[model samples]
Target: MKDEEIIELYFKRNERAIEETDVKYGNYLESIANNILNDDLDVEECLNDTYLKTWDKIPPTRPKVFKAFLAKIARELAFDKYRASRSKKRGNGTMHEILDELEECIPASNGVEQSILGQELENIIADYVRSLPEREAFIFLSRYFYADDITAISKKYGISKNNVSVTLSRLRAKLRTRLVKEGYLAS
Candidate 1:
C-alpha cells in the first residue's frame, strides 16, 4: 500500500493501518531495533512498542515521510530499551559504542540553557550532514544515526574496514570543526 493510503487508514482509525505498515516496514524497523538492542527478544519487543507508538501518534501527526517516521520511532524505542537494560546490567553495547564514537564531537547537555542548545545543536548537525557529499552523508548516517557497525558499513560500500574507520574518523573531525565554528564547542 502507498504511504498516503496507510496514513489515511490511520486518520480513519482503522486497525489495518498497523498491518499495512508492518507489511511495508517490519523488516526495516526490525533491523533498526536490532542494531541498538542486539537481541532477538528485545528487537521484537521494541518493534511492538514502535507500532503501538505509531498508532497513537499518527491520528494527530501525519508524517511527510512515513518510512522515516517509522524509522525514527523504532530507533527511539530501541534506544530506550537499550538504556533500560544497560542500566540494569551496566554492560556495554552497540549504542554505547556509537555514542562514545561521537562523544567528542557532540557536547553533553546539562541544564535548561544546555537543553535549548541541544535543539540548536541538532539543527547544526542536520545542516552539516546535508552539506556532505552523498556517499559521505550515507556513511555518516549509517554509523551515527543507524548505529551500524564499521564492518557492516564497509561491506555495504565495498570498502575495506580500515577505510570505513578512517572515513568516520575524518568525518568526526570535520564535525568537531563545524561545532567549534558555530561556537558550540570551544576552539
Candidate 2:
C-alpha cells in the first residue's frame, strides 16, 4: 500500500495498518535495524518496536512524510537497542565503521557537542548536504541517515552497487572538504 493509504489506516486506528506496513516496509526496516544491531533476534525486536512506535505516534502525529517518519523511529530505536546491548567501546557495524575513512581529511577531535540544538545541527548538516551533487547527497543520506544497505540503496536509486560505492566515495571526499571549511574538523 502507498504511504498515504497506510497513514490513513493508521489514523483510523485500523489494526490492519500494522500488517500492511510490515508487508510494505518490513524488509526495508529490517535492513536498517540489522545494520545497527547485527543480530537477527535484535533486528526482529527492533521491527516490532517500530510498529508499536508508529501506532503510538500516528493518532496525534499525522506525518507529512510517512516513510521518513517510520524510518527515523526505527533507526533511533535500533541504535538505542544496540547501545544498550553493548558497551561504548563496542559500536555497531554501521556507517560509523567508514567514518574513519574520512578522519584523515578532517580530524575527529574537532567534533561538535551533542547538546547543541537539533535544528542548528540539522541546518549545518543540511547546508553540507546541499553542497553535494544531488545524487551524492541522496545516496549519502540513504546510506547513513536512512541506514539503507548497499543492495537496497542501489535498487532504490536505480544504480549498480559499484556505482553506489563510487558515488559514496566521491561524496565522502566532498563532505570532508566541506567539513573542514565549516570548521567542524581540523585543517
Candidate 3:
C-alpha cells in the first residue's frame, strides 16, 4: 500500500492500518530493532511497539515518509531496550561488537545517548556518510546501519567480497579521521 493510503487508514482509525504497515515495512522495522537488540524476542517486542507507537502518534503527527518515521521509532525503541537491558555492555552480538569497534575510535559524549547530543551525533555521522564515495558509502551503511551481511551487500551492490572489505576499511579510516578532526575523538 502507498504511504498516503496508510495515512488515510490511520486517520480513519482503522486497525488495519497496522496490518498494512507491517505488511509493507515489517522487515525494515524488524532490522532496525535487530541492530540494537541482538535477540529475536527483544526485536519482536520492538516491532510490535513500533506499530503501537505509530498508532498512538498518528492523530497528532502524520509523518511524510512512513518508512523513515517507522524506522526512527524502531531505532529509538531498540536503543532504549538495549540500554535498559544493558545488552550492549555484554557484547552478546555482532552489532554490539562492530559498534564497540567504532566506539573505540570515536567515543560518545556526555549523557549524549539520551539527549540532544544524539541528534548532534546523527548530524556528524550523516555528514560523514554523505562524504563517502558511492559504493563505499552504500556498503558501509549496509553493514553498519542496516546490519546487512557482507555478501548480501556485495551482491546487492554488484561488488566483490574483497571490494566490500577494502571499502569498509577505507571508510572506517576516513570516519575515524573526521571524528578526530571534529573533536569527537582523540584516540
Candidate 4:
C-alpha cells in the first residue's frame, strides 16, 4: 500500500493502518531498533511501542514522509529502552559508542539555556548535513542517525572500514567547527 493510503487508514481510525505500516516498514524499523539495541527481545518491544506510538500520533499529525516518521519513532523508543536498560548497569553498547563519537560536536543538555537552544542546535546540524556532499552526508547519517557501525557503513557504501573511520572523523571535526561558529560550542 502507498503511504497516502496508509495515512488515510490512520485518519479513518482503522487498525489495518498499523498492519499495512508493519508490512511496509517492519524490517526497516527492526533494523533501526536493532542497530541501537542488539538484543532481540528489546528490539521487539521497541517495535511494538513504535507501532502504538505511531497509531496515536498519526490522527492529529500526518507525516510528510511516512517511512521517516516511523523510523524516528522507532529510533526514539529504542534509545529510551537502551537508556533504561543501561541505567540499571552501566555497560558498553552500540548506542553508547555512537554517542561517544558525537560527544565532541554535540553539547550535552545540562542547563536550561542549552535545553532552550536544542531546537536551534538541531537546525544548525541539519543545515550542515544538508551542505555536505551526497556520499559524505550518507556516511554521516548512517553512523550518527541510524546508529550503524563502521563495518556496516563501509560495506553499504563500498568503502574500506579505515576510510569510513577517516571520513567520520573528518565529518565530526567539520561539525565541531560549524557548531563553534554557530556559538553552540566555544571555539
- State the C-alpha lDDT per candidate: 0.92, 0.79, 0.81, 0.94
For candidate 4, lDDT tens digit of each residue in 1-187? 9999999999999999999999999999999999999999999999999999999998899999999999999998998998899899887867888889899989889999999999899899999999999999999999998999999998999999999999999999999999988888888
Which structure is stronger by lDDT: 1 or 2? 1
Q: Which candidate number maximizes TM-score?
A: 4
The true-versus-predicted C-alpha distance at residue 66 of model 4, in Å, is: 0.4
How many clashes would you count in candidate 1?
0
RMSD of 3: 2.9
lDDT per residue as tens, model 2, 1-187: 7888998998999999999999998998997888777789989999999999999999889899887788889999987887577655666455455444444543433335644444554576678788777878888888777666778789999999999888877777776677668666666
Candidate 4 TM-score over all chains jointly? 0.97
Could you tell which candidate, 1 or 3, scores higher by TM-score? 1
- Can you write out model 1's per-residue Cα lDDT over 1-187, one digit (the tens) per residue? 9999999999999999999999999999999999898999999999999999999998899999999999999998988888799889976766788888898998888778889888789899999999999999999999988999988999999999999999999999999999999998898
Question: Candidate 3: misplaced stretches above 4 Å?
Answer: 35-38, 87-91, 112-114, 158-162
> What are the TM-scores, per candidate, against the unseen true structure?
0.95, 0.71, 0.80, 0.97
Candidate 4 Cα lDDT to native? 0.94
Model 4 weakest 10-residue run by lDDT? 89-98
Task: Determine which window of 10 residues in candidate 1 has minimal summed lDDT.
Answer: 90-99
- Give per-model CA RMSD: 1.2, 4.1, 2.9, 0.9
